[model samples]
Target chain A: MKELYNLGLSEIDIKNIIETYPEIKDLTDEEIAKNIEILKNINCNDKHIRNILIANPYYLNRSINDIKSLIMKLKEINIVNINLLFDSNPFLLNRDSYEIDEYIKKELEEGKKLEIIVDELESNPYIIDEK
Target chain B: MIVDELKRYMLEYGFNNEDINKILAVYTFKENEILFFNIKKINTLLETLGYTQNDIVKMAKRFPLLYSYSMKNIKQKIKDMQKLGYSYNDVIKIIKQLPAIYGYSIEENIKQKIKDMLELGYSYNDIIKMTKQLPSIYSYSIENIKQKIELYRLMNISHILVEKATYLMQSCELSFARYMFYKNKGIIIDENNYPKLFIDQLKFKRLYGIDNKTLIQMYNYDEYFSKEKNVLIKI
Candidate 1:
């Protein structure tokens, strides 16, 4: 662990990352390293990793259940247009994880049908299911 | 002083216009008065001042009355006091003491002298030249002449240099004189013994952060033409 810590991944870096993304505060050093490795394999730079962690709290926290549930919900919605979702919630276009409760409430207030709202939410990459 | 006593003597001897003016010609170095005398244009002057040839002749005969009256009516009576070689200070003093003698104040009288000098085929440069030589005519000193020349020269030189020269000249710094020679083609010091570029050179050195010692050094190296030597550094 100490050797891993010495590989340019200091305790300070972990602390800063956890503070910036509070949902990842409980993640162990190994989990954080694994997440960074996955992001690195995808050719993500420091800025991209920071941005991704900032946008996707569930990924930073290593919540597999949350990721699975979000995928299932997206498959059920069957969204055909990604642009419509981006137009509705531009924040979702860049990030892969975010709270969808407020968007749901806004859809309900606008009297949008549940299926239409679901389709819009599924098109957004950032929105995920709580279940 | 001799001219004043001669004037008194002319009054005492009852010398006419021709005689008194002839004596004036002998005593004064001004060519204009001599020109006036040679041309017999004294009559024209008398006529313009509302005096006749007979009146001038009569006044010349009674020098005390003529002198008294001339002093009283110097401005209104004389169209060309300058032609008579009246110094600016003398003209001003006479104007101030004998306000009834001239229709204008001392300053206005000086301006008129300047105007008349200009009209007499004198260029602005020539007038400035004369003014510098005879600042006593305008009640100015060498410093005053230098300041006026600097102001007039600023119209041609860069504003930055002009400002520098003005500061140095006004402060009576000798280095400013040297700077003037280097900043531009040496401005001809007017007849008044005032340096033309005095103000501009002083201003240039001051604004550009060139010290007086460095400017003096640059001035000293007239034969040397190197960039390193010209460049001024702060100590």
Candidate 2:
């Protein structure tokens, strides 16, 4: 928790995260610190970074390479608020490039504006699930 | 001082020395009212569920959210599933597979979905099996799930296969274009290979005989994939 505290999460952020996902306690300081750095490098806003971790406490469990690819995938699609995208679906980072590309292409084919698809990605990953 | 205080606190709640040690082992000792409150809430919930001391410690370490959820909400989520035909033990197992199930809004997400599935001739046993196999299906709205089902029907995908392969199929990340593109090229979206839709763009194009330039053109043209109807093979 102190490691998270040092990485720009406030006392409140740490407390809220722990209360939400106590398994975060087992995350090593180094592992969490690395993910924090990865997210910071991609988005660079403390609040956004905190939100990503809070929404997807499992972010620390993914490889940094996987996280980077997810960020790159969104950047490829020109999404402005990458943090918001991650916040809605932390699993986005775990999705392969094919999944991300197909999502964008599928929405475009249905006459959905690209921006709307991006908006949905950031708003609720649930909508993208196959019904 | 805080550790000492927490030990006394848990002891008062009928938690034994072993239980206190287990809880302390899973968390860093921080002196805060909310933290202790959460610890108490989590312990009480687990005890009522008949979790052994060892099981509580393990669950706490592996899935801390188990401890943080309001016991009331957890019970409600379980009871709701029981009403949907899963036994109490089955509900417990489902939550273990998808802890986030407890976080879902039942009325908005779960209830209508079960009702809709039943209307479509899916039995409670079938739905429960699907839910257990693909716990994330609970995340989708009833309409969203129906739309996907409708797409399969529209494409003339085998009805038997759709029902038999639903758990794996429901979770694929494929979209309408990807689905039709493969169908146009004589590729069936099977439970095994439907994931091709989620493959790397270049590899998918190469594997399925589509081209990047055409896809890019389709992507840029924007309004529709093309002006002509059924131009899916144009790729």
Candidate 3:
């Protein structure tokens, strides 16, 4: 761990990082060195690694593959999180991609000038049955 | 420097005095680089033309290079014209002369309206409620009660229905009326499930033996239909 401190991190930074990431707190010197090497291999800089460790200590001892998996999960749940963000900033939400499609389909009939793509989804019996 | 060019462009474009002044008000001038002017006056003329201040500001900011010539002096000139009383159409002509103003987009206008409505004593929920009725109203001017009335007329909503819907929308917890109003004409309702098709309330009253006052009260109270538990005892 001391050899890995090539960037000369401050005592506060080390303490903060260790406090933030519980996994790093219990790691032996050899384990910390291994984790640092793994982090560097994954294109993560020391600052980023430190920030992530501080934010979620449990991820400190996790493999790079596990971290990548966590990010994938975040993207998978993007829609639900995006909706929550939209709830706070409705004006910023892009109407074209959001509920506008469903709104147009449910509210308007076929051949309407503004009929959204959702209308196509709803009108197609195959899709409905498949769903 | 750009002011001169804007003047030349305006002359080339065959803009009138009112229109030229409007452009001058919205355009700004840097003192050291060139003589500058306030563009706020142009805002009033744009207002008369039905263009919001935000829209004009956006246009000026977006097309600084294209409109740089007159942009500097346009703002002050617009303010002067407003003092004398110019129309918004005249102002919009100048705004049109400028390219795109990002700040004056429709989304910004809606936000401004929501802010104004809140300042005018509308509650957060009421503002949201009104938004449901007239979604476009968020972008358009809410000060124009006439437009609201016209929207109601266009929706074929009767005065009695308006009274009922208004009462229901305002007093009852139902937000469907607002949704319906925005969906159809901007008329709020007590319930979303209620038939929104154009059915004259007067005719309904005559046919159903329901009085206007009672209907209005019922709609407001969310008691349009008398279920056993929902019966309103006139105390």
Highest lDDT among the candidates is held by which one?
Answer: 2
Strongest candidate by DockQ: 2
What does candidate 1's lDDT look like per residue over B81-169, in tens digits?
45445555544433332222232233344564466545534455555445443332232222223433444343333223222322221
What are the per-model C-alpha RMSD values against the true structure? Answer: 43.5, 14.0, 25.9
Per-residue error (Å), model 3, residue B78: 54
TM-score of 1: 0.21
**How much is A36 displaced in model 2, in angstroms?**
21
What are the per-residue Cα lDDT tens digits for candidate 2 across A1-131? 66677656656445555654566788788888888887777654554455456544655666577567767787887665555345434445544455577668888998988766765554345454431
User: What DockQ do you compute for every candidate structure?
Assistant: 0.00, 0.05, 0.01
lDDT of each: 0.39, 0.56, 0.37
Candidate 1 Cα RMSD after full superposition onto the native fold (Å): 43.5
Question: What's candidate 1's i-RMS value?
Answer: 45.7
TM-scores of chain A across the candidates, in order, are: 0.39, 0.68, 0.39
- Compare candidates 1 and 3 on lDDT and give the better one: 1
Kindly list the per-residue Cα lDDT of model 1 for residues A1-131, writing each as its tens digit.
33224333445444433433343555576776675565454334343344333323234444344334433443444543222232222223222222244455666888987665764343222232211
Candidate 2 deviant stretches above 4 angstroms: A1-131, B1-31, B47-68, B119-121, B158-175, B186-206, B209-235
Per residue, candidate 3 scores C-alpha lDDT tens digits across B1-235 of 7666656654554444444554454333344224333233333444565655445543432232223323334454445433423344443343343222211222334344556666655565565554443332322223232223333343344243332423221111112223333344444432343343323334444565653334433433233313353322221
